[model samples]
Target: MTFPAPIDPPARLLMGPGPISAYPSVLRAMSAPLVGQYDPFMTATMNETQSLYRDVFATANDATVLIDGTSRAGIEAAITSLVRPGEKVLVPVFGRFGHLLAEIAERALADVHTIEVEWGQVFTPSAIEEAITRVKPTLLALVQGDTSTTMCQPLEEIGEICRRHGVLFYTDATASLGGNDFEADAWGLDAATAGLQKCLGGPSGSAPLTLSDRAVEVVRSRSRIEAGIREEGDASADDFVRSNYFDLGMVLDYWGPRRLNHHTEATSMLYGARECARVLLLEGRNAVIERHRRIGDAMLAGVRGLGLDVFGDVAHKMTNVVAVEIPDGVAGDAARQAMLTDFGIEIGTSFGPLHGRVWRIGTMGYNARPDAVFSTLAALEHVLRRFGARVPVGGGVDAAAEALT
Candidate 1:
């Protein structure tokens, strides 16, 4: 059988829920020469990356580090290490990703309890607090932004609530960080994890994570020395983390001064993650978030101008992603295909309850620009019209441009 010729892929604009176009600098950084895992330069680069992500996470926690896998790896690492078997964990489900948190916790053998709100809505702080009080959970795990519904759960008050209730709090900020407001220390979050593929402007290989002192203590208590490096006096716990690769205690040690052997770090991914954080910090976190807000507003206005209704509560929607209802006459998949084939643009489809009902469009990372937003709007309008939807000519682009002004 013949294999494909030398690699070549079509150039296209990614305007989907995630895995958006990475910043050019991030791509370049990943192409740099590889270095030995414990090389002085490599360790220094890792430390610098940690420092940069602390600013990105808006925290001063010394436990901040990168997990050498996708964002889900960080999520599992935090849950598996911090939540021992039989521990109660409360997850407030608003959309698909909230369910994901519960699933991960369940796999960790946690006594996971979940409270549900509709997919397009978020849990109120009071509602989540009530659940916490009733369940008396050891940890409250939630997602800050669930791209499935384009809704961002309000975390500021929830964090405070968890503190009052003596429940450790963790949030997956993969889709929200960099383009939204997240204060790990200020909000009292015990642990938080993020990915580079969304608003951070990089590919989806590295997970940036941060843990407060309290969360670190929980992990340290369960720390077990790796077998190869185990000494007589080394610490080990009876109930060690289930997954070796997803153990935060060992991961932290590897990233810390001990530099104990764990997995061989993904060096290229480290470079990309470092560059992603560096670019965001250089641009100023607040400024980058505001840019997302403006671009999101423009996109929202453009879709509305095309006579499309938005899903979920507009006030609570994520700044990076917007879910627009598919018009009655338009075939969602066909329209998406037309946009991709004819205009070289890609938008997202929905999941679960929202499937075939809304198109999840993203203005995130390097693609969160006025030109990108405008082009997407224009292309979408054309597709909708061709599919027999009554979209106003030029209205989408016009509204977007006006919103920017």
Candidate 2:
């Protein structure tokens, strides 16, 4: 049998919307020697990680923990655990991720209701309130920042609306957490979930999530009932969550003081997650967010100065990603290929409605820097010109440099 060669890979600047370059320290953290899941040191690390992410979420909730899968897992866990079958779930659809939330809720046997805006626009608070009044769903699941359309939906006022309507509020922050402002408690989020791969400067796999006391009450209700039944030698689990793997209550117990074993922890991912939070907190959370904001603005300016029209409302776009219209007469995929092959840089292709019409460029995590921004701008200029598009010789880099200054 033939074996593949040792994993040698090319070095490419990841300027696309996600899974950007992980921090070097985070990579090293994964190489640290593993230990037993219940070892004292391991448990302490887990507890410390929970505290670190509390500051990251800007929340005081004691139920904060890490989910074993990707950000999607966190989403499913929060939704399924909180809303039992046949409960009403309202999802505000702005882009692809919103649709994902609705689909997940539907699979959880929820009576799903949806409200949508145009791809590039977001819903007004009043619109959401109106929907809540009409649909009166038990839960409102929304996406905070969706990379698909480069839109960050304003969540502050909507939380209050959900509260007034007595609806549980949850948001998927996978695309926006580290790069944009997110206040879980202050914003009255009943549940919020995020992944490390975006602005956290780490690889995907570990999903950090937090739950409010109310959400916890709902989730633990099932656990209490199921545990009681199990102790009585009853095998029935009619009241238990459908998914054992993504069950947030079980995950919380494992992360909590009980140390109730669920699955064996992903030791390396936990290390990487801990280092990611440490790096963010060490640098100061607000400072890292500012860096993403600065670099993202520069990338937007660079694209504009390079003679590209940006997609979506500029005011609502996230701080780490921008979508630029694919210039007429230039093939989108071909230009992206040239950017990769010639310059060893990768910018993203659009998703859903924006596909083939625009390119999504990201300045996130470890790659959100002045040098990375300028380098991407420089390469983009060459690619656009080679594709027979009219672009200024140094317009992109010059504009980005000016923005940085």
Candidate 3:
């Protein structure tokens, strides 16, 4: 395949699972010249980044930070560091990402137990309480939102249950953090991980994480000092963790005043993550969440106006994204292809049992705008009609306008 010299593509809307529209400021931050990994100025910026992300995460924990990889890295770091081998971890499976938590726990040699829920629904506080009581797990790992089926799991009530049972509650907020209302400390979440690509309006290369004092204790108990960093007079520490790279003890030491070397911190990605949190904090967390809520509601109304059935529990739907059923007589693949090729729009298809039955539409981060919502609906209306799906002319746009207003 031959590629032409760079030419800018037309501004097409992104309404997919992730890597949604990034803010111009974040892009510009990435383009700035790089500095040495251990530069004093870089460390100062890193400290500031942590401070900004603390506000974004709504936590006062000093351990709040950005990991060098994508959202999954944050999850792995949190899991591998917090869950020691032979410890029981209770996971309630509702979507694909819950399966991810189970798999990661299994890799960690954890005694994993699962409470399965039906697709398109979430677990109740009582259900999780029963699981925790039965398993007596040391850790509870769950996802705040699973994009595979467009389901947002209720976390506040579940967190309280974990707290009561003396279980360390951990969550992957990759798809929901900045898009919804999350109170890390108030809700009793021991640790939470997120990606920059979702509602933060940044690239996917950075993962932000926060941990409470309970989580810090877990890490401190398992911490291990690096061999290279040892000195003649220094004695070995038993609290050292197994994995050198993912060790939060090492990371915290490096991030703290010690200024030791860990990974050659992704300098530009740090800038991007910093700006992402700064932008969200500047907008105010509640206001940012409200913006996503308004736009998501508009998108839902637009889909309904197009005569399509919205999937999942509408009452518990996430503020950042939505799921809609593929109407009868129209090929889901054909409609999606038309939306991509003709309208330059990108949406998502579901997985597992919902495969070929639902279309996932997202209104997240920089794309959460009234104009973006209307444009996507208008394009989808035309595409649906073109595929023999019955849709009233301008109905989707009209409904979305009313909802946005």
Candidate 1 per-residue lDDT over residues 1-405, each given as its tens digit: 989899788998999998899899999999999999999999999999999999999999999999988999999999999998899999999999988999999999999999999888988888998899899999999999999999999988887898888999999999999998889999999999999999999999899999999998898877666444344344354367767788788899899999988889999999999999999889999999999999999999999988899999999999999999999978999999999999999999989999999999999989999999989998998899899999899999999999999
Candidate 3 local Cα displacement, residue 224, angstroms: 1.5
Where's the lowest-lDDT run of ten residues in candidate 2?
224-233
How badly does each model clash, as a count of residue pairs?
A: 0, 0, 6
Span of 10 residues, lowest total lDDT, candidate 1: 226-235
Encode model 2's per-residue lDDT on 62-127: one tens digit a residue: 999999889898999998898878889999999999999999999999999999999999989999
lDDT at 284, model 2: 95
Per-residue lDDT tens digits for candidate 3, residues 246-304, read: 88877877888887788899989999999999889899999999999999999999999
Q: With candidate 1 superimposed using the best TM-score fit, by how many Å does residue 155's alpha carbon deviate from the native?
A: 0.9
**TM-score attained by model 3:** 0.94
Q: If ranked by lDDT, best first, what sequence of candidates would result?
A: 1, 2, 3
Pairs of colliding residues, candidate 1:
none
Segments in model 1 whose C-alpha atoms lie over 4 Å from true places: 1-3, 226-238
> What order do candidates take by TM-score, descending?
2, 1, 3
The C-alpha lDDT values of all candidates are: 0.92, 0.92, 0.88
